[model samples]
Target: MKDNGSTKYDLLIERLCETFGALYQGVTIDKNWLCERFGIAERTAYRDLARLAHVLDEVSNGRFKLTANLLPSLHMGHLAEFANFAGVAHLFPHHDGQSLRKRMNNADNIAIHGASSRENQQYGDLMNSLDKAMTDRTEVTCFYRGKSRRLQPYRLINHYGLWYLAAVEQGRLKSFELARIAQFAATQIAFEPDASIIEELDTTSGIRFGKRTDVTLHVSAHAATFVTRRPLFPAQRLLKEHEDGSITIATAISDQNTLFRWLRYWLPDIRIVAPATLSTAFMKDLQARCEPTTSEQPQDA
Candidate 1:
């Protein structure tokens, strides 16, 4: 039987792992043995071994072993290359092999603390269903937020350590939080995946979907260095840097709350420059927040 979409990927991962395991044990493996062991075609086995050709050395009679240099330590470069081939390089944060290897080896030197993404175990079946639907270009029917939704499944996106399904419902691009999705089922109805939607998903910098508006801001000299040091917003662009150490930047935001929260954090150091309405609204909001509440009024002596 032909392997389904996710099964193919799973089988590939399994084959790669077993291949490395055998190589690590100093056992010589050949395409014929791999075909027999994995119940795969000889061509598929050849392709699998070819992916590791960079780190494998022939050991006579069509068998190959891990290059001697790689045996002393796990060669991260070769491993990264294999990961890239398997289409899982994005799963890792570091693109460079050296940095990743260092982090792996120097565990005691690093301190990591933050809200990490929840494991996908609960959504495994849902993710698999969506993956197959996307792979097959099929439509999906699911319940989102206690309402039935018919969507053209596009891509699974992870933003800010949360998983979301980016799909089209009623001809509008939207993101549904993975935790909220339920009763997902694939339909035989197939639809052509729009290239534009795919491009938008690839280009979108945040989970907030739908139309986006560009907001311009002025970063005072006091905060320019901090703002320029790293990207603070989605699709951030440095428009101009003034000689006085101040800078002008622009970024796209799909949700006003996201921008508002960011502005609140930066406070006086950052101010909206364009779309005067946003600036006016932000100032009004600040003034309202600064106003004394009835409960804080001075009581009669």
Candidate 2:
């Protein structure tokens, strides 16, 4: 009793695949049930079952019933893709995409990275802006605040989960933090036949002062707090904590102003333990603050 008279062979294969997949989960694949489902004869149901077993063996070496051991065929990154697709095929709770049909297709073709990158969320946005700026190669005025001063768009950088925009303003290179930016809107003012380029202020590595600095430090041979503390900076490694409780914490800071203040506060708690020069600077500041002033009224002398 068939009416859809296309290819009974194709229908047989599809039903066989489904029946086998369901049976792998302990569901019984009865020939009577198959006849009822696909409106095929009992004889055709038996033939389909044979084909299903053959196909599974050929593809998976008997490992797959419903879902294959994906690692044998796919990257771990692709698991995220599958999850994303499942979430979508279940119907998007919010339709941000243009076409529901296209979304379904996109879900079917997804590839995702299982591991997370440390890049800040703004990194992607900055990259997009940089792409636009690079495409235009123009003077884009991004609203840092107040007056929208114009800037020559440059490059975007991603460093240790931070996003930075390197641009030129009034012929001086400026590095702006994407997080601190109030708004970013590229302006139309542009450059052409630009023979002039600023080199000295070429900001890189998120540094405004674009200079290789020489620093020096000094430490008390007796101060100690890092004996039980973790490495303070990403590059920091625990060199040693001396027997006298003096611990040496090694770190390189992007800026020295904050570190200098912190070292002062950690006074008596810890010391610089290096370079000799910073220790002297701290001592000088401390001595200056402690100096007795000269405003005396005679008492009983």
TM-scores, in order shown?
0.66, 0.38
| Residue 277 lDDT (model 2) | 69
Off by over 4 Å in 1: 1-78, 81-99, 112-115, 285-301
Off by over 4 Å in 2: 1-75, 78-131, 134-139, 143-174, 179-184, 187-209, 212-229, 234-241, 249-254, 273-277, 283-301
Task: Supply the global lDDT for candidate 2.
Answer: 0.55
Residue lDDT tens for model 2, 1-301: 5567557566756776667645443333555667787788878867665665543333333233323431244432243355465443334443433244345567867564342445465456656876787678866656785656677766665444456666777766667767766656776766762433344333223344333333322334643444335343334555665676555556555455555676667677666555576667667877876776655435575
Q: Write the per-residue lDDT of candidate 1 for residues 56-169, one digit (tens) a residue.
A: 999896889899987746555566666676455665688456556666688897775544788878888889989999899999998888799999989887776788989999
Alpha carbon deviation, residue 41, candidate 1 (Å): 38
Cα error, residue 120 of model 2, in Å, equals 11
Q: State how far residue 250 of model 2 sits from its true place (Å).
A: 4.5
On the 0 to 100 scale, the lDDT of residue 285 in model 2 is 72
Total residue pair clashes for candidate 1 = 0
State each model's C-alpha RMSD to the native.
Answer: 13.0, 15.5
* lDDT of all predictions: 0.84, 0.55
* TM-score, candidate number 2: 0.38
